[model samples]
Target: MKILITGANGLLGQKLVGLLAEKEVEIIATGKGNSRLPNPDTFTYVTMDICNANEVMETIKTHQPDVIVNTAAMTQVDQCETEKEACWDLNVNAVEHLIKASEANNAFLLHLSTDFIFDGADGPYDEEASANPLSYYGESKLAAEELLQKSNIRWAIARTVLVYGIAHDMSRSNIILWVKNSIEQGKDLKIVDDQWRTPTLAEDLAMGCWLIAEKQAEGVFNISGKDLLTPYDMAMMTCDYFQLDKSYIEKVDGSIFQQTAKRPAKTGFNINKAREILGYEPHSFEEGIKILHEQISAQ
Candidate 1:
């Protein structure tokens, strides 16, 4: 099978490229620039912007991939709140372009979405729950999902949360890097105790997405980690796993942190649909932290 992955240099995209290498599938990886990911010689690399509909369509037409996994997005929550137009262009408009290309090429689209669509008024949301996004980023993602539903195309939308892992670009911000940096610097960390989520390991999420895509699963699915915890809890687990000083970690309420975007207080998903449909069983937060520590130490 020929597969094309957008945002190939990202945390989830890089891992997906690595995981699919052993599957005997043809992989075509694309990024926004000339940066290439570490892969076998069989993998193809393309540098193009998804926002350019004509370029994206041309690339898809040339590749003629059976599946197109879109991992590209403007993921910064606070930044999206301030730059609404840019956020919509990338998150919503770019998706519309990709959907159009996928339809033209007769390829299945695997779109990566976020769990921030919930308003946090509802805890541990299931697939049947209503989406009441509190931020512009979530609103844009929801709008994109709605567009896909109305579009006449074969697709799967995976709503994941709190993804963190090593990436080609270390400059990218994630929860794991934030905690690791705080511990390495011996600085006091103030983590939000009230903001809850099922923090997913990027590796696990990548595998789940590949499974769903390969199976040609349709509609929306909530694919995230099994364990639910707050940012403070995650920091404490990281400190424990890495043998860092736990005293440096302090708890803070989410309401106190003034931000341009309003974050959901409790955004964990049930993920029962993923478990039953895709047979996906994600690792716990502790296990995820241990694996991350081992990976970092090995590097």
Candidate 2:
């Protein structure tokens, strides 16, 4: 099988590339600029911008991949709020471009969406949950999902939450890494307790996408960690995993931080659909931390 991944430089994109390397399928990894993958020679790497309509069309046409996994997006909520046009271009418009390309190439399009689509009023949402996005980032993602929903192409939406993991050649930090590093440096951190999420490990999310691709699954599926936790909970767990000082971690609420984007108070996914249909299972948050530790230690 031939699979092309967008945003190959990002965390989820890099994880997907690494995961796909072990499989028998052929990979075409595409990013906006020079590939940041540790082993770019392992597979086909292309510098194709998803935001460019002509480029997207030409690249997909040239590759004619059996599956197109789009991991690219302007995911920063505040950034999206500040730069609405760029956000919509990458999130929604680029999706339309991919949809058109997929129609032309007859490829199954697997899109990576966020849990932000739902308001925090009530969470641990199923695939059938009604969406009421509170932020521009969420709105952009939802618009992309709606495009796919209304399109006549083969597509699947893999919605995830608070994805955290290590990636090759990446200086980017997630909650786990941030907590560990901060505690090691003896820096006190204020973490929000009011907000909740099922923080997904990047590898688990990659696996979920792979399952959808392998099955050519249609419609939406929640692919995230089973645990529903807050930032404070995650910090405590991180401390436990690393045997660090918990006194440095302060539990706070959302109002403390002044941010451009409004965060959902509670938004996690219910992965029952994915578990039942795709046989998907994810690691516990502690187990996920252990995995990160192994990677960091090896590095």
Candidate 3:
């Protein structure tokens, strides 16, 4: 099987590329800028920006992949709120382009989505739950999901929550790293206890996407960690794992931090459907931390 991955330079995309490389499938890794992968020669790499309609169409046409895994999007909540047009163009319009190209090639399109699609009034949402996005980022993601639902092509959406993991290039810093760094430096950290999520490991999310592509699954799948935790919970866990002082961590509510985008107080996913259907088993939150620690230490 041949797979074309967009945003290959990103955390999920890079993870997907590395995971698929060990398998029998062919990989076509495409990103917006120059390739930042550890070994660019391992697979076919293309510099195709998904925001460009012509480029997206032409790239898909050229590769003619069996499956197209789209992990690219403008995900910064505040940035999406302030720059609405760019958000829609990448999150919604670019998806339209991929859907069109997928239909033309009759390829399976597996797109990555987010837990932000739901309002925090409810917790642990299933695949069939109603969507009430609170912010522009969530709205744009929901719009893209709507496009796929109405389309005729074979498609699947893997919606995840607060994904955290160390990437190959160390270009991204997640909650684990942030908390670890602050606490290790003896700096007091203020974490919001109100906002809750089923924080996902990036590797687990990548595996979920691979399962969707491998099975040619259709419809939406809630792929995330099973633990429902707040930022303060995660911070304390990091402290315990790294043997740091918990006194340096201050638990606070969401209102303390002023931000442009309004975050949902609680948005966690119920991954029972994925577990039953795809045989998906993700690492526990503690196990995920250990894995990250090992990776960080290795580097």
Candidate 4:
């Protein structure tokens, strides 16, 4: 199968590229910047700014891939809150471009969504749950999902939460890495106890996307880690895994931090739909930590 993946430099995109590298498939990997993937021969790299409709059209036409997995977005919650126009452009407008282009090309699309679409009034949502987003980021993502539903094309939305793993030259750090690094360096860290999530392993998310592509699954699927854990629990687990001093980790509530964006108190996913329909099973948080450790250690 021929696949075109956007945001190939990001965590999920890089994981998809790596996984597909081992398969007998052609990959067209596009990112906003130069490709950071080490395996040059694994996929063809294309520089694309999806917000530009022209670039989107050109990239889609050139590849005409059987599947397009769009992982690109302005995912930083605070950044999305501050840069509303930029967020909407990337998250919603670009999706419109992709939907039109994908429909024209007859390519199946597998788009990524987040758990933030829910207000966290109640959590562990399935695909059937109603959305009531509180933040601009969540609103933007939900808008994109709405667009996909309207577009008369084959598509699937894979909603995940707290995706954590190592990627090549990544600017962001996952909770496990952050906790392990901070504690080892003797830096005191304040982790929030109020917020809870089913922190997804990046590999598992990539696999979920792959499953969507391989099966050509339509509609929405919740693809995330099975364990619902608070940030404090994650920190403690990270400390335990690394045998680091947990004393440096101070548990705090959301009240103390003055974040630009309002975070959902608890947004976990019910993955029974994914498991039953796609045969998807995610790794436990501890296993995810161990896998992350292995990757970082090898690096």
Candidate 5:
């Protein structure tokens, strides 16, 4: 099988490439520019912008891939609030272009989404729950989902949360990295005690994506981690796991920090859909942190 992955240098995309490298499939990876990742000899790279519909179509036509996994997005929550047009263009418009290209090339498209679509009014949302996005970033992702549903193409949407792990050449700035950096630098870390999510490890999420692609599972699926915790709780756990000073971590309410984007108070998701359909059993938050610590130690 010939597979093409967008955003190949990203946290999740790089992990996916590593996982798929052992398989018999031929992989063609692409990013916004000339960013390259450490990979096996079998893999190939292309630098193409997804926003250019004509260029995207031409590339898809040339590659003739059987599957296209799209992980590209403007995921900065605060930035999306101010740069609404750019956010929509990258998240929504670019996805539409990819969907059209996938249809033309007769390829199955697996698009990565986020758990931010929930308003946080509810504690934990299932796949059947309706999306009520609180931020422009979430709204743009939801709009992309709507477009995918309307298009006459083979597609699957995976909604994930708090993804963190090793990347190829790009720097990842997730909650895990922030806490690690603070502890390593002997600096105090202030984390929000109210905001909650099921922090997923990028490696586990990559495996789940491969399963979904292999099964050709269509429709929406919540592929988040099993455990849920607030940012403060996650920081404490990370400190404990790494044998760092707990005094360096402090808890702060979400309202204390003013931001352009409104974060969901409790946006944890229930991954029963993934568990039942894809047989996906994600690691707990503690296990994820332990793995992260080990990966960091290796570097």
Candidate 6:
């Protein structure tokens, strides 16, 4: 199997590249910048920006990979709200480019989406849940999903939630990392108690994508962590895991902070379909933290 991974420098993309390379597959890792992978020789690296349609098409044509796993996107929620055009270009237009090229190349596309497609009025969303985005980031992702559906190509949407893990030269910090850092520094933290999510481990998300590609599964699937937790709950767990003082953590609602984007009150995922069909099993939030801690310690 030949696989082309976009955003290969990203958290999930890196995980996919690492895991898929171990399988009987030829991996082509593409991203906008230079590769940050441990050893560049592990896989073929191509500098292709998802936002550039010409570049995307050229890369797809050149590789002609069997599967195109697109993980590139403007994922910052507040940034997306402020820079709506950039968000749409990356999340929507870039996906359209991939869809067109994938169809031409006859490559199955396993695209990563977010649980934010829901309005969060009701949580733990399944594959059948209607998309009602509360923020621009969600709107962009939902639009991208629509593009895939409208296309005439074999595609699968793996909707994940609150993906957290260690990565190779990660630009952004996840909730677990942030909480652990704050606790380690003895900094006072005010975590939101209102928002709920089934925070996914990055490795689990990568595995879910690989399963979809390997099984040639189509349509939508909710791929996320099993436990539903609020940010406060995760913070407490991080504190517990690191043996740090939890007294510095304060539980607060969404109203305490003034942000650019409106957050969904609750947007966890119901991943029973993934479990039943793909035989997907995800780590618990605590287990994920433990894994991250181990990885950090080893480094």
Model 1 has an lDDT value of 0.87
Of the candidates shown, which would achieve the greatest lDDT relative to the real structure? 2
Q: List the residue pairs that clash in candidate 3.
A: none
Q: Using Cα atoms with residue i matched to residue i, what is each candidate's TM-score against the true structure?
A: 0.96, 0.99, 0.99, 0.98, 0.96, 0.98
Report the C-alpha lDDT of model 1 over 64-150, residue by residue, as the tens digit: 999999999999999999999999999999999999999999999999998888899877888778999999999999999999999
What RMSD value applies to candidate 6? Answer: 1.1
Q: lDDT values of the candidates?
A: 0.87, 0.94, 0.93, 0.92, 0.87, 0.91
Candidate with the larger TM-score of 1 and 3: 3
**Model 6: pairs clashing at backbone N, Cα or C within 3 Å:** none
- Error of model 3, residue 177, in angstroms: 0.8
User: Candidate 4, residues 67-146: lDDT per residue as tens digits?
Assistant: 99999999999999999999999999999999989998999999999999999988978899999998999999999999
Which lDDT tens digits does candidate 2 get at residues 224-265?
999999999999999988899999999999999999999999
Q: Which ranking of candidates, highest lDDT first? A: 2, 3, 4, 6, 1, 5
Candidate 2 similarity to native, TM-score: 0.99
Stretches of candidate 5 exceeding 4 Å from the true structure: none
Stretch of 10 with least lDDT, candidate 3: 34-43
Which pairs of residues have clashing backbones in candidate 4?
none
- In candidate 2, stretches whose alpha carbon ends up further than 4 angstroms from where it belongs are none
For model 1 the local lDDT of residue 180 reads: 75
Where is the poorest 10-residue window by lDDT in model 2? 164-173
After superposition, the stretches of candidate 4 with alpha carbons farther than 4 Å from their true spots are none
List candidate 3 stretches off by more than 4 Å: none
